[model samples]
Target chain A: DVKVTQSSRYLVKRTGEKVFLECVQDMDHENMFWYRQDPGLGLRLIYFSYDVKMKEKGDIPEGYSVSREKKERFSLILESASTNQTSMYLCASLNRDTTEAFFGQGTRLTVV
Target chain B: AQRVTQPEKLLSVFKGAPVELKCNYSYSGSPELFWYVQYSRQRLQLLLRHISRESIKGFTADLNKGETSFHLKKPFAQEEDSAMYYCALSGSGYGQNFVFGPGTRLSVLP
Candidate 1:
């Protein structure tokens, strides 16, 4: 079975503070993705990395950046956290050309 | 641009009753469709894909290109089958980003 693990299951940060969300996958998948889940908005992609050091902006990449220094780890960074940024974040990984993706439990971030 | 739409926000049914979750898509070219499920307190998981044409957990979905719809159906609902279902689609070209629907929460009553 494939395992995708997020660094934190829940987090709280003050406004204007910087935040980091880490994800690691044991499957060594080539594709890693960061998404935010909101009510009635579904899962909107924030950023994705296809390979080490290679990153692409998804539909909702504003105020967010990604790092993929290694194949097994992907990190999402928020430049300045705000109350509106509070939401559940999910990480996923998939094999090259495979449509099936495995997701982590998700981190619910609260910005006050 | 590729997009997926799941109209219903919630659906309720009794055990042994048939259930269908409607999903529609808007894509210019051929696209891959998938149904994902997230049970209570569990991480989201893929239920099935249109390309495979196989039934999983007694649930099946058929992609109709003309109608641009991929609706999931099950002959009988089980108590354990209650979960949040999401419809997703991937475009035929370029980046491999997938568009997902808002999702439908299904509740199966005993």
Candidate 2:
């Protein structure tokens, strides 16, 4: 089965702290994405990487950055955590052959 | 710019009732539409794609170019079918990022 694994299921951080959320896929997909889910907001794309070492900003990329140093891993970074940043973060991997994306179990992050 | 909308945030139906989830999109060019589902405690997954034109787990979606809508339907709703459904739109433009709708939460009552 195809699997996209997120590093954490739940995380709590203090305000002004740096936060890192990691995602890894075993399918060797060429495209990886990071999104944050909020009530009535759905999933807003934060960043996506189409190839190793290449990154693109999505609609809601502010206050967030991404690192794709390797093919299997894509990491989302928050420069400074704030209460507004608390949300369920999802990671997905998509291959070139299909438009469908496989998602991870998501990480619920809380900033206080 | 491409956008997707799922107007209803919460929908409930008794078991064996017909189910329909509406989705609409706006894009300048031809777009590929998809339905994604997430069950309780399960990872999100693709339920169906417009290009395939196939029914998945008793759910089907049709793309209407004139209306710019891709709605998912099922003949019967089951308790197991309760999930969070998201409509997504992907275009060939430079944006490349897939845009997803706000999503609808379906609850099938016993």
Candidate 3:
């Protein structure tokens, strides 16, 4: 089975602190994505990477950035955490040839 | 730009009843659509995709290109089917990012 692993399941950070959410995929999928899941708004894409060092901003990329220096790992960075930034972050990886996406367990972040 | 829309925010039905979750899309090119289900405390997973043309867990979706819709339907809903359902669209391009709908929460009452 394809596996996507997230670094943390829950986190609490002080406001203005820089935060990083890490994700790794064992399937060597070329496409990786970061999304923030909210109750009513659903999952809004934050950023995505298709190749090593290549990234694209999604619908909601205001306070977040992403890095994909290696093929197996993708990281999401919050420039300065804020209360409104607290959300459930999900990481997903997909094979370029297929549209099926494999997802990680998700990280629930709280900016206090 | 591609977008997916799920009209109903919540759907309620009794066990063994028929259920339909509406999904529509707005995209210029051919769209690849999928239905994803997240059960209670479970990671979101793919329930079905349009290309497969197969039913999963007795649920099926048909791509209506003329209407730009892919509605998920299941006859005789089960209690286990209650979950959060999301419809997604994949654009045609390099690095095709997926656009997901707001999602519908299905409640199956026994």
Which candidate gets the maximum lDDT versus the true structure? 3
Task: Place model 2 in a CAPRI quality band.
Answer: medium
Backbone clashes in model 1, listed as residue pairs: none
Q: What is candidate 2's lDDT per residue for A1-112, written digit by digit as tens?
A: 7499999999999999999999999998888999999989999989998889999999999899999999999999999998999999999988667777889999999999
**Each candidate's DockQ score against the native complex?**
0.68, 0.68, 0.81
Q: Please write out the lDDT profile of model 1 over residues A55-99, one tens digit for every residue.
A: 988889999999999999999999999899999999998765677
| Cα displacement (Å) at residue A66, model 2 | 0.7
Q: How well is candidate 3 docked (DockQ)?
A: 0.81
lDDT of 3 by residue, B13-75 (tens): 999999999999999988899999999999999999999899999999999999999999999
Q: Each model's C-alpha lDDT? A: 0.92, 0.93, 0.94
**Tens-place lDDT digits, model 2, residues B27-108:** 9989999999988888888999999999999999999999999999999999999999999988764436788999999999
Task: For candidate 1, write residues B1-110 as lDDT tens digits.
Answer: 77888999999999999999999999987889999999999999999999999999999999999999999999999999999999998765445777789899999999
Alpha carbon deviation, residue B17, candidate 3 (Å): 0.4
Q: Candidate 2 regions off by >4 Å?
A: B93-95
Quality class of the docking in candidate 3, CAPRI style: high
Cα distance off (Å), candidate 1, residue B80: 1.1
| TM-score of predicted chain A against the true chain A, for each candidate | 0.96, 0.97, 0.97
